[model samples]
Target: MAEQLEPETILREISDLEGRIEELRQAANMPVPDLRATLDAALVELELALTALRTMGVDQANAAGRSATAETERRVLRTVFQDAPVPLFLLDRDAGVRRVNKQAAAMLGTSPGYVSGKQFIAFCDLPARAALRSQLAAVVRTGRRRRTEVRFLGREHPVDAMVTMARVWIRGEPDPMIVVAAGATAVPDGPADDERPTRTATPAAGTAGGAAREAAPLSDDRDDEVMAALVHRMDVLATASELLLDEPVFNENVAVRRCARLLTAEMTEWVFIDLTPPRAGPASAGGTGAPGAAGHEANGDLRRVVVMGQPDEHGEETVHSLEQLAPEPGTLPHTVFTTRQSALRPHVEDLDLLGVCADGQPACVKMGATSVLCVPVEDGDRCIGTITLASRGEHGPLDLLDLGVAQRLGRLLALVIRASRLYQRRDEIAVSLQASLLPQRLPQIPGVEVAGLYRAATHGIEVGGDFYDVFPAAGGGWGMVLGDVCGKGQEAAAVTAAARHGVRALSGWKSDPAEVLSMVNQALLDEERFVTAVMAGLTVGGEGMKATLASAGHPPAIVIRPDGMVRYASSGGVPLGLFEDFEVGTQVIELAAGDTLFLHSDGVLDACDMSRRQFGQERLLEVLAGHAAAPLQEMLNAVEQRLIDYCDGDLRDDVSMLAVRRQPTPLN
Candidate 1:
């Protein structure tokens, strides 16, 4: 039975037990008996228990003190944040608005509660939102403050502000919250904020907004005079550019003179245009022909285009045919041409004036010229020509505006000149290619009247890939071939030639239309090009003409009867070069006296008008029905004329057509 005792009682008993044990051990003189070890261990255990109880009491007191202190601090922080004057926002890691102070909500034109959980960037002006979001993200990562001036506001005129971002820790969050604060807002380029731009109106600084304050007045009368001169120069340049660019660009020399004449009479007393030939390289940006190549090919050599002078007494400009002189180095005109830049001799009153004009001499001495501006005519990277403008007494020294206008005129002149050259070259090639490739003559189909007409596209000058041929085949009958390659240029041309000759070679003595087309298709497969074709074998006799037609992705042919009945002969198959071995279907048509057979390429129905509406197959049938009784030649003419009217001369593709009609039995 253990004694139940209070702490004081236990201590007394343990003290008495210890004294008894020690006394017994001393009487027995047994080296202070082993009972002391057990008593000492018990004493240590009792001391540990007392220390834990005292520590628990101290911890309870400190917890209560800390809770009161934390509550007071939280209340103080909330009060300060709620009353702050400037706009403020508390943002979470994603920049979501966790809290917004009253001023911030009002400034943003929204209620505080409504803004919670919304993105902070949404309140900023559209143009300023991007920068604001970047700055906010940076502050969150670095845990530092950042500031930037950008536009703000959702609906009204954008308000410019110096936005500040700070990282701060809020209660219950492990990471710091971003505090978005802003300084006073101001309008950009307004009366209050001189640095901001006004909308649309270009100011002295070339911004959208006007100056913050009114701009300082122009310095003096000379500035006013300069403006007046610039106004007059701009008007002349604009008129000249419009006139030169109107309609088709004329001769290069004529174009240069048009520009020269304006500045000669109004701005400069004399204008000297010396055209250096285009560099003999691969090709100018404006052309595809080699130098000296026929058509628009520039001669690839330098020459003087024009030298015109304006005498004070003479009202109009006079063309000068003076002998060309060797130009010395370092002259204004030579320097501009060599450097591909412009040269201005502001006050050439006493400056050496030999190389300023073409032929290494003063151009308008008779006009009493004292100033000169020389600008190089540049086409892309190469300097192609030089424009020399000499100022006489009446016109004052050239200003920046005058020089700028001259530089611009020089560039426009260069472009038009190069374009004109290319246009000429393209025309010559079109005529030559047409003459060589198209059939020169077609044989008469014994008892039938046959005729075909072809027209090139109205787009850019490109060779037509549309081709046709009528040749005698075996059995005294004739076979006709018509088709269009997929694209234009030399590639399509090669395929066109192959299809024509292939049909003739395979149809030596009345061959199958499908077999002829299959052989041609095999030859074209390796080229990776597509072709649409229609091959017809026709035999004319006393009864009428029998025709066998095969198509490879081409439009079906049409037959018109004497009574105005229209019918289509459709043979559908994949286009040539698509599959190595594919079946081609054929349509056999029986033609009677007074019946007209029509074959055509897609270009006929695919012709596009200015409005881009296609001259569709339905409309073509209507035209054919109307001219059903007309002669074969007349019918072809009518179809061509109707197509022209529908397309308004704005052709989108090449058109090819063939019409054959059996002559009616003599006066039945």
Candidate 2:
């Protein structure tokens, strides 16, 4: 028989065995053969010694009786848990549901399997989630039982309940488990916490209405706090809405930056707005052609567009650094975008959650992030980007209320982004269409240096109606047309195209400038749009160039002689498309060597400054006369620069100009 050892002696042997095992574990780094085998043998010996100590001097009947008692205790505990009067839940350290008793499952209106592994706080009302989360965290941090009032959201109406959480320690488990028991509390007839007013009046003691009001309890301080928070959130949203809609011209850069700043002011310490780039071509599935509703496509990455934080001396530098660091895979922002879900970490354990910064440091650590929240910027069912909020020093960790506000704000921002991209696409198309309608390269006249310039209005997004062309006509002559349609946008673009192409086609059949203008007017009569134009037919000669000029209610063409002499051609008839019988004014002009004929739209004379003073025809004449000897292209550029300076670059209309200079005949 084995010698029976005292209890103290057995405990001392166990302690010695533990010390030996620790020493062996520490020696694992050494270059020893069969180290794993030696460790396994030692563990087996420890287990056998423990068994011997338990059985030492104990009869088989007594050991069996102890085992039976342990079994009965476990069964009793299991039965109490499943049939407990109140709902009971078992949760892991992270608040993940490990198990739920039958009563708990029934209270949550779900089966145990369905509720397992889900966050317990997710079953609470949105406004209560943050508070409940804080309570659970307190219970874990202090290892003390905690109780809080929460509104569970699974029933027809929100059920008010009191939840109590206590830590349970089980052998062989590294961390304590959380046991949460919930009991139904009184359901108030008043509004919910979020809807309650900031201040509630106490009813008079004797009046009937007062007594009835007192029957239902007034809101407590917690409800008032929630109401204030809701008010603040609504105020922020109102300001954001105004910021989005207040500008007539939505500058996407300004809007995005402003929204980020707004959130930093009221929501969290740091704000990051990232966007998936707009896909080229038509929008993909579920796309609505509503202005800028082009769906954004994600290719596993997001572009950070806005970075906002507390304003300080190093704020700009910090922003620049963060902007340079795009969120990487596994980072909070990128994870949110990819998963199309919101992520709220009340305490940031992962340092690289925000990705690495330009200084080769974890972004979250560099920003001193205590909490982080990331939500998708969604367009309908598609996620276009993400908005990430971080709480740093002096700012408490973010909660579920912040998450709710951010999600709503994200939806608003998505719409703004869509509109911005839509207008951007429209501007691009306008530029391309405007380029396509004009002559790419001017046809070279025999003795003439020809140049043209067109400028769209700075105030609007629509394509201007200004058009110009310098094309080779029949009979070795050149036909030049500079015109302005009455309106802007696609409608005016159609008229401008018809008038430009019509003039080119008409000049092919008619050699006289007046005849070509008349034919163009006849075609445009049915277009329901008016056009003002000056057409010139030029022929090279030994002396210089012969120009036949015809005007259809257009600005007079100015003739600048080599000696600074300025002459304006006669004003013409009504604007084209107004009357079929109107006659265009025709003038024959002789361009001596070094002479220039300058034709311009009314926009040149109508350009205005801050004082609303126009840079009129007199200024135009002065510029032309001053630079008359310059190269034709150089002179036109000087005129445009002078106009820009006069108006401070604020153009109210489209400016179009065509200059034809007869160069001196070559001395061969």
| Residue pairs with backbone atoms closer than 3 Å in model 2 (clashes) | none
What lDDT score is found at residue 20 in candidate 2? 41
Our model 1 lands, by Cα RMSD against the true structure, at 34.5
Residue 577, candidate 2: Cα error in Å is 2.7
What lDDT is obtained when candidate 2 is compared to the true structure? 0.72
Q: Per-residue lDDT for 274-381 in model 2, tens only?
A: 987765655531235332333346454488888888644556766687888887777888778877789987545455689877655556644655568999898675
Q: Please, what are the lDDT tens digits per residue for candidate 1 over residues 401-454?
A: 667888988888877877766665655566567556668877776668888888
TM-score of each: 0.51, 0.66
Where model 2 places Cα greater than 4 Å from the true spot, the runs are 1-228, 284-300, 310-321, 350-352, 356-361, 666-668
Alpha-carbon lDDT, every model:
0.64, 0.72
Residue pairs clashing in model 1 are 188-196, 188-197, 189-196, 197-209, 198-208, 198-209, 295-425, 296-421, 296-425, 474-509
Residue 398 lDDT in candidate 2:
61
